[model samples]
Target: MNSDPDRQVPFLSYGFRPFFLFAGLYAVLAIAAWTGWLALHDMPGVWITPTFAGPPQQWHAHEMIFGFGMAVVSGFMLTAVPSWTGARRIAGTPLLLLALLWLAGRAAIWFSAFLPPIVVAIADLAHLPVLAVMVLGGLMVRPAPRNLVFFVFLALLTVANVMIHAEWWDFTSDTASPALDAAVLLLALMVAIIGGRVVPAFTRNVLVMRGPSTALPRSFAWLDRVSLASLAILAGLAAAQIEGPPTALVAGVAAAGHLGRLSFWRGMATGGAPILWSLHLAYLFLGLGLAALALAHATGMLAVSAALHLLAIGAIGGMTLAMMTRAALGHTGRPLRVVRPIAGAYALVALAALVRALGVDLLPGHYMAVIYVAGILWVAGFGIFSAVYAPILVGPPLPKNPPSA
Candidate 1:
């Protein structure tokens, strides 16, 4: 096997190279389309007609979670697994084929009306399992015990996706919401697992690189295990749609466990660096969102959708953007620094989370307006990231040795 990857064409040489760009582009276009549909679909002379299977709301949520979120995950895993397990990375033909699978899923969902429901579901559902095979198979070669839990989450996610499609195909009744809820919680668990590792490490790296003698984060074994177990239990209960005092109790306990887990991470020291701070903030949103979810189950004072948005836009969206930016720069051999526009991009996404999660609840009279504003902010933030990173993603990787060197 050739050790040197063909870098003449950068996009196909590495997993993160193309998938990050595609995920960012899709985030912008999907949200814009969803917003247009929401604001104008019922108007007398709307120009763009949105056509798809299932209710518009479900379609939007499905695309955001299963479509955009999965793309980011695929990119990250493809690149990160090599580092974790010392296995050969997926590149060249294999990488391109995986990307095509993802693209095909997106297109099948968009034009689902023209195809049979089962066909559409099959097309959209094939990517994740293949992704799992690639990741777990690679890990099997090296056998990392700690990272093995990701396979369990991936399995649960695939089951949720199947339930979602089952509801759409009329094989089941009202399964989509609980399935989506389950999927969201599973992703949050991944965020917890990944974020717990990366956040403290990144913070420690920055401080050490800058010659600071700060006390780094300490990991608590009991808290870590408890948090993961609680989240897994929550995902199962959510999928079963078991609500009432028991559900509320589990949610509350899970929330507290996660909060305790985060407190051990040195989030306060990450303030000066946007790249590091964004991740801490995103993880913070996860804890807060889970707490709000507990409140929703207990008192019914807040809409479940609000809590969902907090996890969706805040945790998933924020963390993906932060990771993409950092990974793109690091893989390209550039300095670990955030540009001004990218910093602004991070802020815009955070603002989107705030407005979507809280603004709609506080100002009921202007619900649509709030959504439109949040959509615009979300789109613009991702659009900015796409534009800024396109050159790096498509062009040759940054030269290892500059002419000056």
Candidate 2:
């Protein structure tokens, strides 16, 4: 552990420690409480009395993307962008303030049903889009060629968020779904973009493992560019769903492009490391989510609602879970060994995603049962991560320069 708090207090220095710590803690408590809200709705002492008026479906949709998913995005962006641009880390007072913004937003959303709807509109929708501004603002001032596009992503996310808020405010129902889709796709794109860069880099650094050698795939940077173009075209079509065959075409291509991007990352040799496998598997959800949607849309029989949870629970939720776990451990200066509980935690989350996806369809009568188990598993997964990592944050960090993976 660094004896000097001053040193670690710098944003990049503490890296994923603080955000990951708080995020994991919040994940367990927040999602569990939310799950409880779904089943046992009359608990008064619960977090601010569930107020957002909807069936559990839409509420869960909003919270998981806006709630659990947003927190992970905050942690990763605050921690990583500074390092990417050689800018000073957003730590001490500013970092803490940003975290408060997140917490306040959560509070506002929790009591949203009770409060006026507009209040929920301003508070819940405001944070991350603003976060996009803050993060990109730093990066834009002193640009890194490799990273500037991410800033575009951060900004586009804000636009999607505004559309989401607009939908909630009774502007239109169609906008919300597309906005939600864009946000998840953007996150997956970020994961694919960033993960492609970091995962193998981290793996090689840790295990001294070489990249897989099966006539290794092309970088396909052009595909990334085209994917963004496809998303933009789809987003426009989404704006007017009734007007365009091009909309369907774009979505189909975008989904396939993401799958190809995943393939190029050379996704093996990850099985040996917990951090590595978790990331690789989470990314697989990205491809799966997109493909599922593409196929769902192509077949007239498929519903849009059925395709979304694939990205929500599986891609977005899983990617966040894997990243928070790995980033927490790595940035904390801890060794890369997995404890048994943590291993079980990983397994539980994967199971949760599967149960939510497959179980819901196959056993309509038992959907709640699947969800209940998923909620339990999700809570347990983060609970374990938080417990193990809490001491690492509140106290001095673990010793620097620990052994490799």
Candidate 3:
């Protein structure tokens, strides 16, 4: 790979370089603070400002989705789209500008009460639009021969944020609060779409690099269409008020489809592959989360509370950490291995999901404890990745400079 040409290069000479590092590090600190304050009742609900919705839930959802989650997406897109299109890397001041905008949004939401609602709203909605511009800009400069239209999903994510902002500003009805749910579903849809391409491709790349004898399974035919269609329909249903029966039916089918798709990835076989397992475990949460939500509605046995946690904490949080860590390592010219502590981070997340899903009723008041643990594990995982990979994201190039030859 060619060296980055920017003059203001620090440790942030690449997109994933700084954003992934800061994002991952922030993942630990933000969630820990969030979980602790919530658990200990140390922080007031009004600690954050208002916009579309109350700061309480807004703070939580925004950080998880756009803060931690969007950071991961930004890192991946900035890193990958350049490679895909042969475009110049986004680095130095421009990258910092984007990161600061994200941080500003987090701060505005955190102290939203002190600031005008419009101020918070502007800062909050700024990151994704900036990101969409950055990504779509790549297409304009040097369009990827085939993946030009992929920006549609990134654009859709931006649209989802518009709905989210509508709720923040009371432009929508009282039911507008559910726009958060719509945003979550939209995030899930993006994960399914992009994760579908990258994880398998990366795994296959690693296997090929190592040797043909170690090739991961390659059957990706039905999964692409089925998961996409299911999520698209689900996204629409999530936005509108659909009847219970149709909702239940779609949820059940999505769960099954996700699970069936995941099975082909051979997660069990990839236990030794930290990069692979991180991706697999994240995907597992997606499948299990869909199933958990479906079963919740179908039987009325579990509340959406547990299911949402499963998706947010488990699927979204877990996968973002996993993918960001993996991509950061690879693109930064580091080995693909997750250090022991980082791997332990994954274990902590798995335990968190189990505790959150199974323990809410079993150990009801301990939600804070589970959340605290989850936040700690989650943050620690990303924190570890930041420590290890920040150096690699900058720097010149790999020592040996070997491609998958």
> Evaluated with TM-score, which candidate comes out highest?
1
Q: Backbone clashes in each candidate structure, one number apiece?
A: 0, 3, 8
Q: List the residue pairs that clash in candidate 3.
A: 28-379, 49-112, 49-113, 51-168, 52-167, 52-168, 52-169, 53-168
193-297 in candidate 3: lDDT tens per residue? 666776677677766766667748565677667876886787677778563667677877887887787777656767678878888888888888888777877
Report the number of the highest-lDDT candidate.
1
Scored by CA lDDT, what does every candidate get?
A: 0.86, 0.67, 0.72
The candidates, ranked best first by TM-score, are 1, 3, 2
lDDT of 3 at 132: 81
Per lDDT, what order, best first? 1, 3, 2
Between candidates 2 and 3, which one is better according to lDDT?
3
What root-mean-square deviation over C-alphas does model 2 reach? 4.6
Worst 10 residues of 2 by lDDT: 3-12
Provide the TM-score for each candidate, comma-separated. 0.95, 0.83, 0.87
In candidate 2, what are the lDDT values of residues 159-186, reduced to their tens digit?
Answer: 8777776766787676777676666666
Off by over 4 Å in 3: 1-10, 42-55, 141-150, 206-216, 390-405
